[model samples]
Target: MVYIAAVVAVVITALVVGDDTRGAAGDPFGADQAIRYIVFLTVGYMLARGLAKAGSWARRDDHG
Candidate 1:
């Protein structure tokens, strides 16, 4: 879980910081980009958590 979150964070950070697809227009950490990063991070976290929970449930069902 921690590993998944870490990877997501790193990937998002790289995209936002790099800003290759979307030009920075001067500020590296532009407010719009910051918002995008935040939104993406939140969604990634939620998905990771849901996946972890589902995996645990499946494992329990398999054993029992």
Candidate 2:
């Protein structure tokens, strides 16, 4: 589910960047910046998940 959400977010972001309905001023940071931000966010999420899983694995208690 998280992966699906990420994919959808990326696609929507791409569409918004490609859109050219803005005024003559144009985008503030532009498409390249937007893409970089999205990639960074995705990596952050993956790293968080990995850390959480590792923590859980290390704290396992076999005794009930």
Candidate 3:
């Protein structure tokens, strides 16, 4: 769900910014940027999940 939301957000952002807004090399929201976006979003999701899991683990009372 998070990944889907991230993709939607990126697409909307690129569309809103317009094609004329592309960077010097080429399309800012082109294939390469899309791949990079996916990779970053996936990594971010994993890190967030890992941190949340760690937090819950730390808060639990194992000796109880």
Candidate 4:
């Protein structure tokens, strides 16, 4: 499940970055854009991890 989420996140992030670059007039590969993409992707992965952990805990509690 984590692997699937990671793959999907990477693909989506790449697509977003690519689109942003193409649509913008100035340099799309600027430092700010790169930083934003990195931040967004990292946050997304963190959220996914947190949710997965929460779900696991919930299941364990229910079983017990």
Candidate 5:
């Protein structure tokens, strides 16, 4: 969770500190791309956390 949050902060900071000379069409890391990256990161993190919890829960049930 901390790693994901750090990555998101870095992405946002990069977007803000990036050069502004390039046109929107020419920029590869535009606002849309950043948003997509953040969304994907969040979803992936959530899915991973859910799977981890499920695995632990199953293990606990089996042991108990």
Candidate 6:
């Protein structure tokens, strides 16, 4: 959720600011770059979460 929100904010700012020229801070990314970054973040987060949950287990005992 945080990643999605951040990317959205960045893309919105870039579009609204309307400046892609290289400045002291370097060139700002466009919408396409933002989309790619979000995709990478999503994939990396999924992999990390999957690894973290791989050892967890839960059960409901009916014999209790």
Angstrom error at residue 3, model 5: 3.4
Best model number under lDDT: 3
Whose TM-score is higher: candidate 4's or candidate 6's? Answer: 6
**lDDT sort, best first:** 3, 5, 6, 2, 1, 4
User: Model 4, 12-48: lDDT tens per residue?
Assistant: 6655654554565764455565557667867888898
Please identify model 1 stretches exceeding 4 Å from their true place.
1-25, 58-64
lDDT for 37 in candidate 3 is 82
Residue-by-residue lDDT tens digits, candidate 6, 17-64: 537465667545667776787788789888988988886564456453
Mind giving the per-residue lDDT tens digits that candidate 2 earns over 1-64? 7766875677677667645765677755566766786788789889999898877844456665
TM-score of each: 0.47, 0.52, 0.57, 0.48, 0.59, 0.53
* Whole-model alpha-carbon lDDT for candidate 2: 0.71
Please give, for residues 13-54, the per-residue lDDT of candidate 5 as tens digits.
657754677766565566777777677777888898889887
Assess each prediction's global lDDT (C-alpha) against the native.
0.67, 0.71, 0.74, 0.64, 0.72, 0.71
Positional deviation of 59 in candidate 4, in angstroms? 9.3
Query: Which pairs of residues collide in candidate 6?
Result: none
| TM-score quality measure for candidate 3 | 0.57
How does candidate 3 score on lDDT?
0.74
In candidate 5, residue 18 scores what lDDT? 47
Whichever of 1 and 3 has more lDDT, that candidate is: 3
Q: Highest TM-score: which candidate?
A: 5
Single out the weakest 10-residue window by summed lDDT for candidate 4.
Answer: 15-24
lDDT of 5: 0.72
